[model samples]
Target: MALSKFGFIVTGAGFEPAGKRVVLSSEAFEMIAVGVPAPADALVVARQLASEGVQLLELCGGFGPVWTAKVIEAVGPGVPVGSVGYGPESIDVMHALFKA
Candidate 1:
C-alpha cells in the first residue's frame, strides 16, 4: 500500500513534544515531526501518532535500540516503527555532539 502519512520523533534537551511539533504535507503525503525532552516521552507520542492514523513511525538516532524497541511495543504491531542509525564513522562526531 502507498504511504499517506508518516510520523518522526526526535529527541533533545528542552524539547517539549506538544510545543515542538510540525507538519509538512504535499498532495501525496503528510509527515509529522515531534520533539521530546527524553526517550520515555516518545512512548506516549508514538501511541498517539498510531491512533492518529500515522502509517509509519521513525525515531532519531538518539532513541537508540532500547528506546526504539520500547516505542515499537508501545505502538503495538500494527504500526511499523524504525529508528535512524549512525555508521561507525559517525560515532566520534555523534558522541561529541551529544556529550553531557
Candidate 2:
C-alpha cells in the first residue's frame, strides 16, 4: 500500500500481556506500526493517531460494529473511519453475502 499516512487500531497479540502499547518504526524502511489492546486502548489510540494527522483510520478486523462505532466516536467526525472487513471497500463481499 502506498499510503503516506495510515493508522490501524489493533487489539490482542501473541506478546506477553495482551494490553501493552506496541510501537514499531523503521527509519530506513519508512514503516511504522502502532498496536493497542482492546476496549480502553482503542479510544486512546484513536485520539493519538488523529493527533498524528492520519488521513485514514482503519479498525482491526476483530472490531465489530459496536466497537467500530466507539472508535469512530472517539476519533470524532473529522477523519474518515473504516475497518478491515465489511466496510465500504468490502461492499462486493457484503453484497455477495447479502444476496446469498
Candidate 3:
C-alpha cells in the first residue's frame, strides 16, 4: 500500500481551539490542532507544521488576501498553499438566499 505524503495546518483569526482534534477526510487526516487567534500566530505555527513535512497547506473560504498571504509566507515556496473561495455561482446563490 502507498500513502501519499500529506499534511496541513488549519488556523484562524479568532476563537482558538488549542489542542483540539478534528477529522478532516476520515481516510485523509485528523489533526490535533494547536489553534491560535491571530494570523501572525498562525504563521508561526504553520511554519512549524511545514517543517514537520507538510507538503500542502490550506485555509478556509472566508480568508481574505492578507490571511492567505501570511499562510503562504509561513509555508514557503516549497509547499503549495491553497484557499477555498466562493465562485461566482456560489456568490449568486448566497445573494439569492440572503436577498441581497
Pick by TM-score: which candidate is best? 1
State TM-scores per candidate.
Answer: 0.94, 0.62, 0.60
Q: For candidate 1, what is the lDDT? A: 0.92
For candidate 3, give the lDDT of residue 15.
49
**Model with the higher lDDT, candidate 1 or 2:** 1
lDDT of 3 at 60: 57
Off by over 4 Å in 2: 1-3, 14-32, 86-100
Clash pairs, model 1 backbone: none
lDDT (10s digit) by residue, model 1, range 1-100: 8999999999988998553889999999999999999999999999999999999999999888999999999999999999999899999998898788
For residue 49, model 3's alpha carbon misses the true position, in angstroms, by 1.5
User: Candidate order by TM-score, highest to lowest?
Assistant: 1, 2, 3
Candidate 3 lDDT by residue in tens digits, 8-91: 445554646342234354555434345565555567666766786666666655446888887887778987777767878698
> Which candidate has the highest lDDT of all?
1
Per-residue lDDT of 95 in model 1: 89
lDDT scores in order: 0.92, 0.67, 0.60
**Per-residue CA lDDT of candidate 2, range 1-100, in tens?**
4555666666665422233444444552222245665555677777877887776788767687888888889989887888776558887875785473
Worst 10 residues of 3 by lDDT: 17-26
lDDT of 3 at 26: 50
